[model samples]
Target chain A: MVQINFAKREINCKLVYYGPGLSGKTTNLEVVHKKAPASKKGELTSIATEGDRTLFFDYMPLELGKVGGMNTKFQLYTVPGQVYYNATRKLVLQGADGVVFVADSQPDKMDENLESFQNLEENLREQGLDPKTIPMVLQWNKRDLPNVLTPEELDAKMNKYGAPTFEAVAVTGDGVFPTLKKLAQIVLEKLNREYGLQNDGPGGGSAPAKEPPKEKEPAKAPAAATPPPKKPAAEPPPAKEPVREPAKAKAQDDRAERERAERERERERERAEREREREKDRERDREKEARPKPRDFNVTPPAQEPAKKGGGKGVLLLLLLIAVIGGAVGAGFAGKLGPLQKHYDDHLRQHLGGGTPAGQ
Target chain B: MAMKPSDTDQKLRKQRLIFYEDDIGRINKALENYQNLSKSRCNMLIDVEGHPVTQVGSTEGINLETIAALVAASFAATKEVAKILGETEFSSLTHQGKNESIQLSIVGDRTILTTIFDSQDTTVGMVMFYTKELVEKLNAIFNEIKSRKDSGKPIFNDDFKDMSGVLDDMFGDV
Candidate 1:
């Protein structure tokens, strides 16, 4: 979870990249690590086994300095790029303030990408995060491959959520930082709105950028909103115009006559406001009362099924077993076919298989 | 080491006349062995077409036609159980109650035996044990028949001559 200080007016947030194995998730992070402003990012730490690769990195914007007023920091993480280690992937994704899905652009890997996305949703559901409301960005990676699907095709396949999608060449740092910046901006906005919640004290609850202190000072001044016109036949707009001033002297006169007329006008207005507010409050209360009593009504959302929860670990375990078993089965097949001396022949075949001869 | 009888091994020669009758002796022996576990007269006669193989326990109070029907029903129930267990090797099925009843089994092909028990005495341990031994004996009988067929001989090779007496003794009360 990211914490923000209203006193310092700053916000912090985390963005994680989630995707399938070999879908260039780690590559996207590598590209960002190489290209981010050197002053602001930390070192990349990788924990890899013979079977999997993990990505861990951070991005701090010195230029954008403080959000509100605290140092704006964006910590980026890439989930492991292997099917088997989904337990670790889910752990990395806990408290994910935001997500960027680095989707592989290969046509054959399309289904794999989609399945991984579904796994992400399932994991998030297990974690109690609604994927739709979570700020998400999609980076369609590996644009350099010739056989890769076109941008339109990939978008049609993966960008159904209307998440900001980017065409990325991670090897050369093409769309890396741009994607990061866009997602970072979104994360920042989400953080502000969330932290800006605390700033919702008395009075209107407009946001920081929308209503600065100087703008609302007059509304807060409480200098008895001036006396009404003695000629009570006057129109409402011009009649209340004196109270709208910020002038110092008028501020004083407005205070005196304002105190007397203000009480009367305040009574009438408060009574009117009270009537309207009370009516609204009762309507709101009645609506609330009616709403909760007939909660079985389809219009009222039913109690959510307490999450049928499990980590990606089961599917991950199955996939891992399948991978090892498949590999063993393949090796057994090859050994049975060619005996112990087959590696030399296989290497030769690999070398001779894809010789570059130009043709259409 | 042990010789066991299997009725399904081969058909017995039809006895035109009986030199002697052991029907009472066999019925007495059956009742002595299984007085506690047996079905009601109504449930035992579950099938109309099946022959009244036997009514094993002391069902003396029930009339002859009812006994015949109950015996046939017992066979049909055993056969149905055989069908359910899939291999036709179904040894036995028994329903149990506490107070009093009758249970029976029909041996088939001598390779498989179908046993059915419907009774208030729900204790089925003895029924299952006896049924398994019976099926094993039946298997040996079928195995002998198979080997005999392999050796290419007529089935009435004198080894099965005594079956007529056994069969007579098994159902002669009718």
Candidate 2:
């Protein structure tokens, strides 16, 4: 989850490092903490056992000085990669906006890498996110070790999502910053798309100018409508010799015209009222759909929420049925409606039951 | 490349705490009042994920960012311990030291309140009482923030090309 604090003009994003035991997940963070400028980094906090293995997690926060007028900060965390600490791993992965999977490249650690990858996918699914769609990067750490798996082999075996991959020796800071920078770029891109943020050029601090004009356009429409009648009334009177009958006729014409304009305005007001009611109904529906569902927190594992998919298929099927009906009527096949209706019903049932529909 | 609308919509549904100017003002005011009444050394607010929200008091020697992270993790670990003991949770945790002590209490569903005070300056009873009262006030403020309709707008533009340069400047020297 991204925290945008308008009060302080700050934006915070969480990024997590995940991998198997002894995979240098912590080493990557340690290297970055050491190399990053003192002004831009915080103290590295680690909760480790007596043997120096991480017991809980290691965290370091980095400050990326003002980006587009907001103080952007990234909180980097490394989950304990030991197998039994999966509960802690799930906790750390809770609100992660992006993930960096640091895979140990040694050939002997292949099984561990695969297991950890599966675990990552399972945890992400439990959080109601698609593993394939989330912003992610892969780092093949321990590249300096002899007899390590080649990048080609690792990509073929463990790069299931085709995420950007880096070869790094985290102990020496090789390829570490590049991996982090790539992850940040993709994460920012995702944020920009989600929030509909426009690029106002480099270092520009101007507020979004698109939304205000859209709102003003609707308000101006009514104001513009009221002024047209006033303009006609303000025009100069005809400069000619006055005849009583012609002047009386002109007065009657003006009265009838005024009544017609008044009736038009009344109809427009009714239409506007109806539009507002429809908008309110739509808003209510949206709120109901968006309301979060309550969950029992005591359960050892996080509750799984069903993935939302197949929404567009229903609308597509409805359109296809309408098109088929129109074509049938054009061919003068109205008498054959019974068979067509039966076929459509069968197709709909098959599609809903997870079977391929006949036509498609 | 363009993203799918459904994907963007799913991303938008994630739980996020957006603090507007008014929301931060109220939170800071509440924290200040708690400090005055409790007479503690200092206090801080952090989310369940260990991100610092705000802090108030004499935080001269303390590393607040580090403390916030540790406190959040400890609170979570304690929650697990509570489950093992057949309880819903232990809402408040206290660590008593020889000269200084700390108190952590869950303010609302999403945030925790932590206060550090010298053992000699205040008793556990006083700190606990003040903590309870402060938690109630903080909870109301959080509820109001959550119900606000116009939280705020995104501050960043789409161009992220400059980020690589910024990272280089910070890390390249080292």
Candidate 3:
């Protein structure tokens, strides 16, 4: 999921494009990269195998500019779409914020499409994400293909989950931006629902009135958003004459500048302190590097010389003491910890980390 | 009154992971070389198979059996509070003894901030308060490490394995 930082006014999220091999998953990403301005897209990484188009995965970080005054970014990724790459695909799906399933719409790729959907379900299950609940949209790609399955048939099969579906010819960028925009908007809506980010949308949408948090206000107030039922405007206190603050506003501006300068000074002070700390850290590290080294720590040098001399008389007694006393101490500590341990075991038995009653 | 944790907090309980065993060790080593901790011991960062991911500390050769139990308890108690208040992660867990104590704080979903203390030297409350701040710093370190790992940027060696879920349904309901 995405999190919006209100104070910094930025939204961070991860969006992954998933599908089977040769489905234009990478093609979709490449199209976005080529179209987006250089400043908006990060360098793309593609790992292609000798025989396959995509070997591992491709990752591109795209800055989706700012939405509602918060900087928006989407890190788009494509899993290597081979049957054998399920392990890597599962890893990449570990923390998906939003998913775009780019299915090849060509008639011959129908079986591949179905298999990929199953794989997606299995991966989502492994990651504990309910496919029904994860923010997702489906994109049927290669729509321009004459032999491609009709949208109705494809939706009936693949988009049966009722996720928002889009048709795209990713090669020529048809329906690409619209798909991205829709998914991005869905991602933002989910973020809003999750984090209460009630900011207006990108097109200057009016802010929705916030529902007051259910706190300790009593029954005297009606629950509706209506104004107070009665107004107590009977007070007759005369209004004070309008105060002219133009002269004072100048002083206020000066104070504001002073505050800004003070903040800058404080920042500089902090930087200097950090530099000093770094220097000291370096000096201390150098000293540690140059310091005299201690002799053997864990090694006992095969217990030679003086140890053998003492072994004749005292060694037997020492060994006996160690064995008997050590055993008793260990047992006592174990017993003391047993009650708490049992309580934990009971809980573990109930939870059954190894999964039972249907978990695989 | 306690602050209400959001549902987003619950995600941290389930899906959050903060891993930095190597970075933590390097930090602890610098502290040890500087004699910051009197015991020259590092508390458990990740309670792995037999030993804690530790570099310095008096908990040398501590049995993993107890720590594993403790980690489970810590998560259970936190989960209870989290589920009740809609929070996902916990601030910290502290246990006091006659002359020692151990504090566990959530640094990241994956990583924990642990502090071992002596009653003769430090108060439990003091350790709790300070460890909270320390865990905040560790949280940043965890985030940095995670982002670096995610971006395919190479850093210090990272050893993350596909471990099973930390808790399960068979575990008693909190």
User: Which candidate gets the maximum DockQ versus the true structure?
Assistant: 2
Model 2 misplaced regions, further than 4 Å: A197-360, B5-14, B150-152, B157-161, B171-174
Docking class of 2: incorrect
Which CAPRI category fits model 3? incorrect
TM-score, candidate 3, is: 0.43
TM-score of chain A, all candidates: 0.52, 0.55, 0.55
Tens-place lDDT digits, model 1, residues B116-145? 333322235545544444444434433443
Candidate 3 wrongly placed segments (more than 4 Å): A3-7, A197-360, B1-107, B110-174
Clash count of each predicted structure: 18, 0, 23
Model 3 chain A: weakest 10-residue lDDT segment is: A228-237
Q: TM-score for every candidate vs. truth? A: 0.36, 0.66, 0.43
Instruction: Write the number of the candidate with greater lDDT, choosing between 1 and 2.
Output: 2
Error of 3 at A298 (Å): 46
**With candidate 2 superimposed using the best TM-score fit, by how many Å does residue B118's alpha carbon deviate from the native?**
1.6
Q: Model 3 misses residue A65 by how many Å?
A: 1.9
- Residue-level lDDT tens digits of model 3 in A13-69: 667889989988998888878877787776676667776487656777677664433
- Give the alpha carbon lDDT tens digit for every residue of A1-360 in model 2: 677766565778889999999999899999989988899999998888988788899999998776544578888999999999998888788778789899999999999999999999999888776777677878888988999998888888998777767778899888677677666756665665444322222233222211111111111122221111100111111223121244664685587457546644654574476457556656655664464422221221222112113356555445544654475455343333333345446646776878863322
Candidates arranged by lDDT, highest first: 2, 3, 1
Error of 3 at B99 (Å): 48
